[model samples]
Target chain A: MTKIYELMPDIQGEEMLILQNLCRDYSEEKLRNFATIYRTRRKDPLLILVLTLVGLAGFAGIHRILLNQIGMGILYFFTGGLCLIGTIVDAVNYQQLTLQFNRRLAMEVHQLLNREV
Target chain B: MWCLLNTFFACVLRTFSKKTFLSLPCKDFKSDDGMKSGIVRFFVHNFEAWFWLTSLILLAFMPPESTQTTFCVWHLLGFESCLGCGLGHSISSAFHGHWITSFKFHPLGLVAIAILTIRIVSVFNQNYTFERLNKKFTHDKNL
Candidate 1:
């Protein structure tokens, strides 16, 4: 039986705990399915951070669009990330943003696996 | 002041570095007792929403023609023009019922307000759903 850590080694700490809690009662096959799907869907915080840094140069808001925030992306695009203050803040809070997105994705995956069962 | 800035930058660098990016500090979730920390956690969790809201309010209150000082880093860096240069004044003018002036200052001022307003609402909605899902799982564990 592969543990959650073995299945998703990149996820750690609170994210790991949350995933474990989510998959508490799942069988090995279902857990594997969930992990596979969730891994592909999850956004990497480091990638987001890099995109945000790029935003400082001229192309602000690509990160927001990548995170499924179209309105914000547009706003950032037009306003230069609210004069780059918003971009700076986003750069600082990249971890929280990624965690929020990944947690939502984890729940969606859990529901998906449940439906398949 | 330098020490504080250095520590802040160091912390930011550490957060972005490959090695420590995955294991985020559990400060937001670890403390459940202190009232102050809980408020801090709430702000941290919904930072984007709060930021837009605060910016809008500040813009609303700012005088339309005041040119005493600017907080724009681009201007500080000696750039003569920036994409967001007049946005703040435009929004402020719009808030003060001068739509024509707002348009003159920045064509997208009104649109920016609308977009930011929508973003704030959507962010709060997302936060609500995330909290509800978290509660649902924690409840199941107690059962």
Candidate 2:
């Protein structure tokens, strides 16, 4: 009897592969949608502001935890939050965060865009 | 002291002054005007239209220095950093032994800069295709 995995081709599309051995389960269709929206729109550059606020508002350093800006996060956590000044600076320059994120995301989608037929 | 102050202010002023976009109003200018126009786009969305309007307003009012400072010009993006912090400082540090300073500024700073420099050289020093192709060659190994 043929399994469902047998019916559907693997990512390489021409081979027999197990579903369990694979990584994330995002389908091409979903990745395509993620790619399309990411490519065609402008994401709000306000995330920097948001992360900045989180960094300031918490002792655990919400900003670092979420954004993975690890070094600063650790610094803030240890120094009794001396980095608030830096966070304020980031809030003021929120546009840069937006632009940088957009550029990186665009690069990510560029890969997907190249992938989709 | 004065030279350092002058340099810092110069960078700040440059930051404010950089012309990030080129624009000509749809009413006043013809789109087909040639080469000096580096890149051009006719904004379709309402948001983009608003952005251009805002840009023009900024063009009219703000000095360049204040604007550049508002960028992610330095690492305090409210969180730690990303891979790109200390990028500006790393090259400057390499000439000096600002190793700890640069690493504190950004871990991937020098590496990112080196890779970027190499890539840029390759792009110009050779031929590269910025392409639109299929996903087979673009598979996600992590997925």
Clash total of candidate 2 = 9
Model 1 per-residue lDDT tens digits across residues A20-86? 7788777898888988999999999999999999989878999999998887888888888877777
**Scoring model 2 with DockQ, what do you get?**
0.06
Across B24-124, the per-residue lDDT of candidate 2 in tens digits comes to 22222344543433222111112212222332233334332221332342234464543222333443454355667656655654453354344334322
* Most lDDT-accurate candidate: 1
Which segments of candidate 1 are over 4 A away from where they belong? B1-36
A111: Cα error in model 1, Å? 1.3
Deviation of model 2 at B94, angstroms: 18
Model 2 over residues A1-117: C-alpha lDDT tens digits? 333243332222111111212212445665445535653553544544665677555453445444444554554454333324345434544443344345345446545655874
Q: For model 1, how does the per-residue alpha-carbon lDDT over B1-143 read when each residue is reduced to its tens digit?
A: 22123335534544444332332223234443455554545555666677678678867887888865566778889988776758888988999999999999999899988988887897789877776777787677668
Find the 10 residues in a row with the least total lDDT in model 2 chain B.
B126-135
Candidate 1, residue A2: how far the Cα is off, in Å: 2.7
**Would you estimate the TM-scores of all the predictions?**
0.84, 0.34
